[model samples]
Target: MSVQQMPEATVPGKEYLTFRIADEEYGIDILKVREIRRYETPTRIARTPVFIKGVVNLRGTIVPIVDLRMKLHLHDDPHYGEFTVVIILNLLDRVVGVVVDSVSDVLKLQQDEISSVPELECAIDHESIEGLGSVAGRMLILLDIEKLMSSVDMGLVPADA
Candidate 1:
């Protein structure tokens, strides 16, 4: 099909759900997001990573809750406040929730708005960074949420799963 004849949603650009962690803004593909819920205490699991806050029951499904701040090592002692929220994501046929400081607005960015990520030595896996998005004087660290969440260290999914 011709570019003009294609659906708007299938065009060159994509929409992202922007959120904040510490002072930096990050984004993930909007399609990965299932829902957003208020912060709630989850049932703690033994012998799990510190980043794995616990599991929460979501409509009969037990969903693992990950704290982005702790997972990315952004904060040594992360504080859960009123603005903290859980972003439920549909990943690899599994439902998982990630806690973020607060959610920003959704942005529909064209390909040109995204720039390649610069090489940097950091705690976050560089591969998980999709690109750097610049829009309206704001810069967003676009993430490949699936890659980040499915990595071996995360233990969210098995090698075959």
Candidate 2:
């Protein structure tokens, strides 16, 4: 889907579900969030990438879980604590879960509070970033979750035949 066609939490006050990876904060459009689930060990699949933690049966549908820490090349052996949870997302008509350190809070940001991400080389791919949001005294890396998840490198979807 085109950027303009991508779903957003843009109802006057845009809202984001904020979460942490290592020490940095990130946000995703709240509209794409299906549910927040506690950290659970998933059934492992053979020959998959390390970042692909595996899959879980969510009510019958098999949902793939990706560890954001590993995917973003953050912490290698991230400690799963009480706060660690999976943010299940509905993107491109598929259900996937992203493991995060902990959820912070839902933030509502006005247009002025959000700024374009500066063109720079970063560990996390810039294409995945929607923009940078300044709230309170913190900076949030707002993510285009759909683009990130559906990207070819992510291997979440099959390439066109």
Candidate 3:
């Protein structure tokens, strides 16, 4: 029902979208993703950070877009093609949008291929990075949606009036 290339994952019945964030490859659980939309004309807010590119209409609900590239000061490779997609993620109890260069295919990483993040960095690395995973010789970083979705930086709240 969606036209998004998620991480290349095929672990038994589990899968994830492995994508490149700058030079790093990261993956998020395919189930958490609501939908991926192509680049839309975002309405610029009068005053806001560059990463926060305002909101867009998804069906009829408004969803915010956060530029993952700008947030990490990562380079955008035009080779990946234009019209970057906005990944709708369901984090915590809210739905947030993440701007990605391009949606990569679903990855199939075995359980053994996944590596947990170092405990030493757990105390200092608060960048929403969950852990690292390896697939077919390539390393894919897993995203901790729980940490990323409820991040104070995004300031997302319940969508109830």
Candidate 4:
């Protein structure tokens, strides 16, 4: 089905795919997720940002992998373990994968559960942060995955896309 025609979750609330980078938990719109695969070594490219882990061949498609931990500067030394997973995302007709420490369960959060991102001076792109979501006393950094992946530095998609 076309992206616009994809079926919504049967439940009323919007769903997010929660994942961890370091101590912090983050979430992205569940609809943007294409698939999750076990972490593998991607072929390195020359002269790319350190955060770009490189590209992997996925069923005839070459997908660039970005390590979110490095991308967000969450961990200075990355430890790739069994739990590491690549969250393949479909953004603006482009497919890309992001490496996260681990994948948590999907959460269906109502509008009231989300709150505005607090004012903070940090290295992270503030605009890419959609909001903060609170659930079961746990805080989740909600991300505008489309905007993050389409960013100019990401070079995954045209900035105008």
Candidate 5:
């Protein structure tokens, strides 16, 4: 319903790192993501959302992994094992990791080619998603990283958490 969700308003043909949270395809700005890391056993934290696996040490920085499925209001328990993947993203100049069902691939969508989200009664927090971008009949949900971190109350660390 906001101006941000208008597909034609998004920058087009720009490459985005696409991934899946459940069956839905989602993507973040490729430049905002640092790298794709495999799920490693992380240090468990107390009093956090179950979807939050824990913290991981990337080089010397401590980053938290957010279960994208849970964040998206989907069933966090995955039906297929192949969907487990952790995507490291740089948000609001802060770096963090997100756990997703699967990493599909990178895609390019141009401005004016994207589609705005239709009015729905669903409970998804649209502030984190910019719009839906598609290519070759395949669609991707654009993500807003700055909104994601704040929504979970996770603050970016200077060098470590």
Candidate 6:
């Protein structure tokens, strides 16, 4: 779907899986999430981008793991302890995993709670952001996972893979 067709803050009462990376919280559409797994050291790949942590064998299916902190340039050393989790997402028929410091909880945000991301040239890639969500005095950076993962720059998946 085109960015224009992408889900914006206009949608009402949408569920999002909230997770933490460094001090910020990010949310992804709950529908796209398959499952959450404990953090495990994945088999590292050679000559891949730094953000692409590597691949994990999940029930015979090899899933690529992306470190959200690295991908978003959070510049924090990822602590792979008990709290770290890998969010498995099924985007565009492809299964991938994203590592986050910890998952908070699934939140159902109302339309009024979300606001369109401000138009600004910032360090974070605007194209990957769905919007800014406010709840309980905290702001959540809602992400368009499909757009972010499939973008050419991420290199999480090969062009033909």
Question: Which candidate gets the maximum lDDT versus the true structure?
Answer: 1
Judged by lDDT relative to the true structure, which candidate is superior, 1 or 2? 1
Candidate 2 similarity to native, TM-score: 0.90
Candidate 4 local accuracy as lDDT? Answer: 0.91
Misplaced by over 4 Å in model 3 are: 1-13, 75-83, 119-127, 158-161
lDDT (C-alpha, whole model) for all candidates: 0.94, 0.92, 0.70, 0.91, 0.74, 0.89
lDDT of 5 by residue, 1-161 (tens): 66655455644377788887766887788888789877776798998777676899899999888776766668856443655767888776666788876788887778765778776766456776778887788888787766766664443333343
What is the per-residue lDDT of model 1 for residues 1-161, given as tens digits with 9 covering 90 to 100?
Answer: 65566555756779999999999999999999999999999999999899999999999999999999999999878899999999999998999999999999899999999999888898888899999999999999999999999988888987676
Best candidate, TM-score: 1
Which candidate would rank higher by lDDT, 1 or 3? 1
Q: Show how many residue pairs clash in every candidate, following the order shown.
A: 0, 0, 16, 0, 6, 0
Model 3: per-residue lDDT, tens digit, 41-127?
577775666667788777787777777776655643322347478889876666778887778888766677777776564322356
TM-score of each: 0.91, 0.90, 0.75, 0.90, 0.79, 0.87
The C-alpha local distance difference test score for the whole of candidate 1 amounts to 0.94
lDDT of 6 by residue, 25-126 (tens): 999999999999999999999988888989999999999999988888887467687899999999988899999999999999988898999889765678
Runs of candidate 6 exceeding 4 Å displacement: 1-12, 157-161
The lDDT of model 6 is 0.89
Give the better candidate number (1 or 5) by lDDT.
1
Q: Give me candidate 5's TM-score against the actual structure.
A: 0.79
What does candidate 3 score in Cα RMSD to the true structure?
9.3
> What tens-digit string does per-residue lDDT give for candidate 4 at 58-120?
999999999999888888679999999999999888899999999999999988899998789
